[model samples]
Target chain A: MRILVCVKRVPAPGAKINITADGRAVDTAHLGFTTSPHEECAVEEAVQIAEAHGGEVTVLTLGPAEAEEQLRYAASVGAHSLVLVPIEEVDWDPQRTAAALTATISGIEAAEGAFDLLLFGNESADAGGFQVGVRVAHALGRPIVNGIKGIDVGDGSVTARREIDGGFEVYEVPTPAVLGVKEGINLPRYPTMKGRLASKKAALVTIEQSTEAGGQLRERLHRPVEQVSETVILGEGPEAAAAVVDVLEELGVLA
Target chain B: MTMLVLCDHDRGTLADASLEALTFGRDLAAAAGVSCEAVVIGKGAEGAVGQLAAYGAAVVHLASHDVLTDFGPEAWGETLAQLVASCGASVVTACGTDRGNEVLAQLAARLDEPFVANCREVDPSGDTWSLTRVQWGGSLLEDATLTADHKIVSVAHHVVEAAPASEPAAGTVAAFSPDLDASLARTVVTDRVVLSRGITLSTAPVVVGGGRGVGSAEAFAPLEELAAELGGVVGCSRAVTNNGWRPHSDQVGQTGTRIAPQVYIASGISGAIQHWVGAMASKHILAINTDREANIVTRADWAVIADLHKVIPAITEEIRRRRG
Candidate 1:
């Protein structure tokens, strides 16, 4: 089984963010960048699938030069190879991003043999667009079972459990497919220093871009506007309860 | 006549977000001076054809194959590609919801068309789209233009309230049985279960979600109770799933689920971008986080700096007492 995990580098979602001075996009001055939260889970899923199935796991991405940091991170996570679509920057929207990714995946399929399993985070944690994996599947005209919470693959097929409305939907799909994993699909392991060191020799492949129709990448992104509301603590202990009661009573609830 | 909208359905029930997308589609179609029709897939949706027509669909194309019951992105893309080619749509529309977005993304790539997902609106210009979309977890809004022959846009969820046309036409229902090679496809649907009564997270007017800060799965009782009282669904954070407190299905985030409720009440969770992406399309966001400056507070319409342990119980009690 050769597994391909699509990974993205996004501003560390845990960091504070603001739009840049141009009001075009998120301010990166105080931000730290890392493997997108869900993509990290994808990388983990890929490596685990490889470990379990006895095959190689390759990491694929599209980004600027500094994005190589993510390839090293993928190595630490146990990826066997890295394919980076070299670009100063890539499209911001899911549509164009999907195109870039589809191009990269096609290039890989042409070089390496067809991938057995393709994994991605349910969606990029920051971009928040759950379009790529399915788009890639569509682009390649391959089967895709997505938003999988539990997966069982053996023999010649893939079985997965996904959450539906109130309960779970269990599915079975053949191999040579795509699976978009949500968090809790599996807990990702922290990269060990040894793994990181060994990852130094992993391969990174880059590709040039074709003209994209949408100029969705030009505009900057910013944080949502802050909304304000008034807050007043009631008081302490018994008095607080009394005041709270009075307030509730005044609102015609406890009266 | 000019647009084809792919309606996302499971079995027979239309995805609620699709209705919201229909609102955008109708508006976009009107702007383009073209009529819009829909292609409905999946089984068990016998009654949905009427609703699709009610939502301004001129015709409802139904393809009720057994394999179509389960969502295979490849087969779906193939189906929609054929639909577009045969139907002669200049544009294809779907909701930015997961399934619709996925199918359209694939369709666009297959057709070599440009698309933008989660676009708030699209101003159609001849053969292009001037689009606006939310970025960085609803922290930013930006505008762009797509120059493509086929302008496909995934309308943002819950951004536009759904209002069907008055005096809906009894849309002509056509049997669309496309050829699909099941052997070549990878996934098959085995079983499915739907929530019994609670409002769907994607379609709910109100959502009450608990995070790890809520402490335990046992803690969800009050939140669930309140969500019920509010006529909403109970949602969980990624931690809730990781801790084995809740199934991963209820986790809301990038890896979890994307939802657009009218009113969202988040309890005890630090608003990580992953978490925020799930429910930020809400009309109103009320965050009750212990941290006064939690990221959720910044994005919320109303922020309450209090422990959910205290607030959830008190609020539930108030609801119970008031019901009396």
Candidate 2:
């Protein structure tokens, strides 16, 4: 039961977003990148599945050189191996990202063996494009159970629950399948210091081949006008309550 | 040959989301210089599919089967793969609701095709089609081309406004029966629990959400009572979900369900950009918070700087005591 968890390095959920001065891309100079929120859950699921079944878990990521940070993080958190496909050119869309990931996974499979299961987050948080997982599955020609919230593996097949119109719909798919892990599927684990250290030293298998997939995305680089403001949080002192009360009443809270 | 849109339905009834999907599908396919068809998937949705013609579908492919009695993702994905192949649709589209996106993702995988989710708009340019998807939680737009002979797309909910049917045009309803492998499904839902009488926050006209500032679980009672009186639904911020006081389904934020209602009354919410992205699409928003400097006050149409503990109970009591 070999499993591959696909991930992306994106600005953290709480990270302050600053568009580049040119307004074509997010300004990452001061921002710290981490595994996408949902990807963390996906990686956790992979580790849990690997621990439950006898297998190894590998993390795959596609991005610039700095994207390897997330791959190293994955290795620290119990993944057996990490693979990074470099898209040195900034702003690779999902099609290209999926292609690069496929090429890297193909090389890995050719060397080792094909994966039994593939896991992905519902979507990346920063880019918020929910396309890579499905695109990868399609490129590989595998059966897929998507956006699964509840999954139980047995009977040589995987049973998963996908949230439907009102409730949930259960689906059974054979092994050698791709499935996107939905939010609330499981609890994500934090990387330990030991894991972090191990991951940093872990060599990432980088693939340089291009998968001839094209899609236009340069238009997103344009900037939008924003009226940014700030709120100074008064220190959490005893007087803070008095100050807050005064402010609230001045705004007509207490008549 | 025209493109086909899968119509989602509830036991013999059509979902409004499906209608919205139908409208989007019809408009998109027509813009691409092709006619549009619809496939209804659910138990006994054959009759309901016939009404899709009002939204411009020329054919409503009905796949009513016993194996489909339950919404099996594998079975449905297989059925769609077969239907798409047989119909030879250049593209298929669905509403970006939870179910629509889930099923569409599976179908895209099964068809071995690329998919674009939460696309806000699609404009055809000769042989190529351009789409603008909500990038970065709707903060920015990613305008790109489809660049595929076949593509699956999910339109963002409410982004493509649903217009009334222009005319009642009759279309052919073909019954599509496909074989489903029951043993392949991983999990099966044995039971369902409906909260707040099944009034989902996404469909509610008025949503009253509570956050960490609500102080305690007991504070939700006022919100629930108020929602009940207003004939609306109760929602919450991610803080409540993080606190484990509410299920993730009730959470309203960037990662949670995005809702746009007529009126949104936020209580105790700090108005984080994530929360704002979810509910700021509402027609009107009223913020109730003790912090006059709260971001919600600026994003909201109206601001009431008050302690929700006192203001909410009073509002509910006033409404209840006011009577019909």
Candidate 3:
């Protein structure tokens, strides 16, 4: 029942996102850093599964040294262990990141034991390559399902549910499988006072990995054209109700 | 070398997003001085070859196998990898739908190459191609470069409008069979559970979204009724889903379904960043919230500063009265 959750640290974008002067990255001076939303939920899901099944939850992250914050956050929320695959660069291409993660996971499993489940965010909030988890699963020779919202552990099998347009698709993969979990899987818990204290004292395990760049490289980062809309106040409260209908009719929604 | 566009279809009907991918692949092929072709996998793909040529595909490769009767990411990727080699394709592209991205990712893993998803623009001028891709579900854009000898990409859904050539190419259809192991079927789709039929949240022209302000699960009745009257479906913010007022499938946000409805009627939603990302793609947004300064109100095209409980029924009544 052991689970490993992979997370990524990304800039916590606000109402408006500002790009760096050179158009190469986000302007992080004013913004804070947090685990990607989906991965945060993935960590929560891992912790919940471990808590219920009587096993340990290991949280792993690949990013700069500052990514330790995300790992500690996972520990504060009941993760039993933490592993940081520290990368010196701002970001690693998906191929290299997957390779590094596959290597790290292999080493961990070899030393300890194979985790029953490996969970990753459906895609990173920042880069959103949507390849790392699939690549890693292939490299590790495991069946993988992406965009999973619900997971049920059965006898040596995992039933994963993914929501489609009108309904959901189900897949059953054997244990020692991989799943890319989405955000709505669970609501992440906040760190308690005792948990925060434990997190502060928790030892952060760092893994040094150097990998070559993948074929895809970040040339620069640029902001999309801002969509500015001037809100036209129809009316106040129930009184504005008629105007709302008028707008809908004008938009042909009522046709 | 040819540029290959992977046509996404259900049985025989082609998806609009796949045509968009063909359009993109055609442009990239032109830039690289190569012919633009398309590859369709699985059952009923042979029927889509003509349509692929209408979008400028000169050659259509139909890769149908017994094991690939349904969508299997690994099998499709493996098939595309073989087609890339057999057809001498320098670049492979697909529409960035859920399946398209998944298949291309598998192909990238199988070939040990780079694959970019949600690309809005691609320039295949030289060995190194620069592209702009969406991040955070199109909330942000990233400029990146691909230097792979065989470039694999997925055009962001709805970024490029699909257009047919003035004169159709009358493309020839060819069949391809890849050697796929039975092991790839391990993760294939086993069962599909249709929750509700007809228009879904993604395809609904009008979406009525409820938020935490709706108070309880029962409070969504009004939103549902209004959506029904408009011949659409109901959506909700993550907060509503987190509160257990609605299911996760009905949630609209960064992690939820990214909708492109004609108009989104978001009621009682404060419009957090996550929710805004999903709803932003809608053609028009009408925010109904008490707080005028709420993020949804400020960003929406139209705002009604009112309690949704009072406004929703009133609007429904107004619409009914107008029809009568």
Candidate 4:
């Protein structure tokens, strides 16, 4: 029941996001870094799965050396192992990221036995390309499903649930499969004092990998014009209640 | 040198997002000095060919197979990959819906090409095409470039309005069947569990959303009643779902359903960034919160500074009173 969870470090944006002067990237000077929200859930899911199944959970990430913070965060949450695929560049397109991950995963699987499951965030918080997980799964020759919210381990099979408009769709994929898990799958746990201490001593494995950039290149970033609308205060409390109903009626919702 | 638009449908009816994709593809193709064709896959896809042409598909390619009865990412990706080669398409595009993005991802994997998702604008003017895509839903935007010989992209949902040509094209319909292996079925949809019958959060014209101030699971009754009175559905924030006061399907946020309701009545919700991304797409937002400085109140089109418990019932009563 060994598992691997992949995560990405992204800027923790506040109420307003500011872009860099050149418009090439987020202005991170004032912002701190944290694991993507979905991947935080991914790490939590992996740890819980390992705890219940009596196995180990390994957390992997491909980013700058600073990504070690994210890996340590995973370790603080009961992950047994950590691997960092350090990239020198500020960003790698989805294709190169997937290729590097595929090669690293192959090497790990060859050394250690194949992990029963591999988990990735449905999409990265920054790029949101929605391709790396699928590409990596294809390269590794494993079945993959995206936008999964629930997972249950069965006899040599993993049942994943994905939510749609009015319902949910389920898939029963065999072990050694891949899943792109979204947030809300589970509420990630905070790091405890003991867990934080252990994380400091946890062994960090760094893999040096280089690959060609993909066809897509980032030219620059530009913020869309803000649509400013002045809020009209109809009334206070139940006094303004009539105005609210009038607005709803005007919108034709109160039919 | 043809641009290929992948049409998405629910077996019988075409998705509005796909028509939007066709509209986007038509413009991109014209800019690239080529024709815009469409590819429809899976069951009941043939029935959508004419409708696609009405939206300006120059040629419609239908790929139907027994195994393609349900949505399988691998199979659809493989089919699109084959179509890209057969049609000699210079660019492939789809709506950035869950299925659309997933299928294009699979195609990118098979062909080892770059695929961009949630793009609001694309300029295929020169060798390096500039793209503006949404990140963190629509809270932030990224301007990037695509330097691929064969570009694959999925337009962000609802970014462009779906428009029909002044004169519908008499597009030709062609059939296609790719050589799909049995292994691709491993991740196919096996079963479906429908929780609600109708008026889902995404499709509901009006949505009544609750938050932490709503208190408990039982407290949602007022919100539900308000939604029912408005002929809409009830939605909630991630905090409400995290508190177990509402189901995940009813949650509105970045990780939850991205809704575009005509008006979203958000009560007691201090809007967080995650929740803002999902609710921002709504045409109009009315926030009811005790805190005037709350994010939802500050950003909403209309605000009522009051306790939702009293204001909700009064609004419902007002609507009922006026009708009587």
Candidate 5:
């Protein structure tokens, strides 16, 4: 029941995202870095599954060397091992990233035994390409599904639940499957002091690799034009309540 | 060379989002001087051909395999991949729904091509299509280039309105049977569970959205009361969900649910770009916050500079009084 989870280091953006002067990447000077929210939950889910099933959870990340911090964070929260595929660039297109991961995973599997399951965030919070997991799974010749919330492991198979409009759709894939986990799958645990100390002493594994840029190439990044609205102040505090009602009535939401 | 659009449907009814894809495909095809076609896969796909025609699909490919009776990413992607090859499609597009992105991603992976999701604009004037796509939800835009033999892209949802063509196309229906192996059904939907039934946050006409200022889970009571009075629902920001004050299901943000209610009552929310992308689609927005300079207040159509604890309850009482 070995599980591998992939996480990406992204800037924890504030109210606005400031692009670099070159317009190619996000300005990180004023921002702090953290793994995407959904990936946090994915790491938590993997650790929980391994804890229950008597296996080890290996956390993998593909980013700059600083991403080792994210891998260590995963270790602090119960991951048994860490793997970092370090890259020099700010980001790679989905295809290139998936290719690098597929090759690295194959090499890892050849060295050790194959993992039973591979987990990824539904999409990276910043790029939101929504395809890396699917691409990697296909390249590795495994069954995969995205937007999964609940996962139940069983003998030789795993049952997953994907949220939809009304309820959820269920899918059961065999061992050696891939799943793109969404947030809310679990509330990730906070790192304890003991866990932090252990994580600091844990061994760090780094894989250096680079792949040719894929077809999708970034030209620049820019902000979308903001919709300027002249807000009409109805009133102040509780006194404005009647004015709000009038506006709602005018909008026809109320009679 | 043809532009192939994948139309999504629920049972026999066509999804509104697919209409947007159709519109985008039609325009791109016209610009490229190529035929625009559509593919609707799964059961009841025939039901959408007429509407697809009205939206300017020159040919509607009805694809069905024994394994495609239900939604499966691999099966559907295989179907689309076969269609792309058979139709000689130069570009493939779909609405950026969960299923749309998933199926097309599978197709891209099978073909080993680059697929861009949530694209606002794509220029096919050159050998490589230049694209402006939504990143970080709709808050930031990325200018990119897609160089592939067959470009695959998904139009961003809610970015464009679905409209019918002034003059409809022939919309000739062609039955398609893709070669699918039984193994593709491994990821097919095995069953379904209906958790709760009713208006959801995305479909609600009125959404009372609360943020960190809501204080606690119990503090959402005033917002709930206000929403119930207006026959709406209560929504929360990612901050609230992160704080464990509300479930992620109730969150209105890029990572949560992208809501397009008629009127959104956002309270105690600073309106970060991530949250704004989800709420910006609302027809009207009213911000209730103590900070006059909050991002949500400045962007909202109307603002009530006050605490939501006082404003929300008062708004509810006023509605009750008027009804009486």
Candidate 6:
């Protein structure tokens, strides 16, 4: 089995996102970057599948040269190979990104062979366009589903689980299919010291590429107006418990 | 030109998100000086047709094909694409749910047009529509332009509240059947598995959430006790989920569940922007934390400065005592 997983290097989430002076991109001077959460999980899933089924896992990314850091990190976690489609821009619209990926993937498959499974995060953490995987799958004329949390690989098909409001729906697509994986599908393993040492020597195959800017063009990026409020402090520590109960009562939930 | 709003439903009931999309599409159509029509696809969409008309749909188009019994991205995309051409729609829109964004992207790919997701604002005055969309789950915004003969977009989830029109439309329902190939059923939903039955995090009226300050997996006991006493569910921040203290299903953040409970008791959570966007939807927030400067505390309607390990149990005890 051959599994391919796509990841993006994004600024560590949970911090306040700041825009650069040019208002076209995020300010990265003081920010640390990591693999987007969902994609990280995807890497772990691919590695696990490869380990169980005795296959090879290849990690692919579309970002700047600095994205090597993320590729190396994936290597440390157990990806057998790394491929980088290096671009100069901070980001591309979904259409352009998908086009570049589709082209690059076709080249890779021609040189080697078609991967049985192609995995992508349901959406990127920063852009969250939620369309690249769909476009790529459509361009390649392959079946794809997004928001998948569970995967059961079979002889010739893969069954995926998509979480709905109350339950999960299952979809079984044939091999050589694409899937947009969501976070929480699996817990990613930490890189061992031996794995880390080996990753430092892991060579990267960089593919320089560019595409015409898609129809969606970014004009500027700005922070949303933060909502300010005056918090009423009831009390401190355990003493505040009674006040908390009173407020809950006022909200009519304590009844 | 007409703007076609794709409405979603479950079984027979229209989804609230679909109403929000209708409200957004109606307003956008009025601004662009175009007619607004709605399309509902698949089984049981007729149940939502009347509500769609009430929400300012000039005409409701019910599209049903034998293959559309279950949700399928390619099939729905094919249906919407054909409807756009048949209806002469210049713009297509839907709510920014997973399915909403997915189907529109599929449609955009089919039509070879640009599709924008989670848009907060749109300007239709120019030849290329200028749009402001949410990035980082509402922490940041991007001003953009969509250059296409056909504009496809999804309204940011919960950014605009669903509102009914003061004057209802004719509520006319028209049947639409799109030309679909048999191969489009490859990605259709095949089976369903019910994991749990009861109040989910999104539906619960009260949510007692924990964060990094909750310390360890075992320490979540007090939070669980408090939540159970309050007849609510327990939620966690991304930090807790990363630490393996709680499952991601219990996480309240951009990548997790967007909860709109009656009251969200946030304890020990620093309220990162991702987490804030999800909890911000709650009607009321009560923050309990050791640091006064934490983001959740400042934004909370009420707060308590203390250790969650002590405060959570005390709150549970106090509530029980009061009930007795």
Winning model by TM-score: 5
**Deviation in angstroms for A122 in model 3?**
0.6
> lDDT per residue, candidate 6, B244-314, as tens digits?
99988888988888899999999989999879988888999999999999989999999999998889999
The candidate with the higher TM-score, 2 or 3, is: 3
For candidate 3 chain B, which ten residues in a row score worst on lDDT?
A: B64-73
Q: Which of the CAPRI classes, incorrect, acceptable, medium or high, describes model 4? A: medium
* Candidate 6 segments exceeding 4 Å error: none
lDDT against true structure, model 1: 0.72
Q: TM-scores across all candidates?
A: 0.84, 0.84, 0.95, 0.96, 0.98, 0.98
In model 3, chain B matches the true chain B with a TM-score of 0.96
What docking grade applies to model 2? acceptable
List residue ranges in candidate 3 displaced over 4 A.
none
lDDT of 2 by residue, A208-234 (tens): 867665544546543234344343343
lDDT of 3 by residue, B230-265 (tens): 999999988888787898889898888888999999
Off by over 4 Å in 4: none
Candidate 5 reaches a DockQ of: 0.85
Docking verdict class for candidate 6: medium
lDDT value for model 3: 0.88
Q: Going through the candidates in order, what is the number of backbone clashes in each?
A: 17, 13, 0, 0, 0, 0
* Quality of candidate 2 docking, DockQ: 0.23
TM-score of predicted chain A against the true chain A, for each candidate: 0.87, 0.82, 0.95, 0.97, 0.98, 0.97
TM-score of chain B of each: 0.81, 0.90, 0.96, 0.97, 0.97, 0.96
Considering TM-score, where higher is better, how would the candidates rank from best to worst?
5, 6, 4, 3, 1, 2
For candidate 4, write residues B98-207 as lDDT tens digits.
88999999998988889999899888888888888998778888888888888999999989889997778777988888778887788888999988888889999999
lDDT of 5 by residue, B254-295 (tens): 788889999999999999977888898999999999999999
Cα deviation in Å at residue A175, candidate 2?
A: 2.7
TM-score of chain A of 5: 0.98
Interface root mean square deviation per prediction: 4.4, 7.0, 1.6, 1.5, 1.0, 1.3
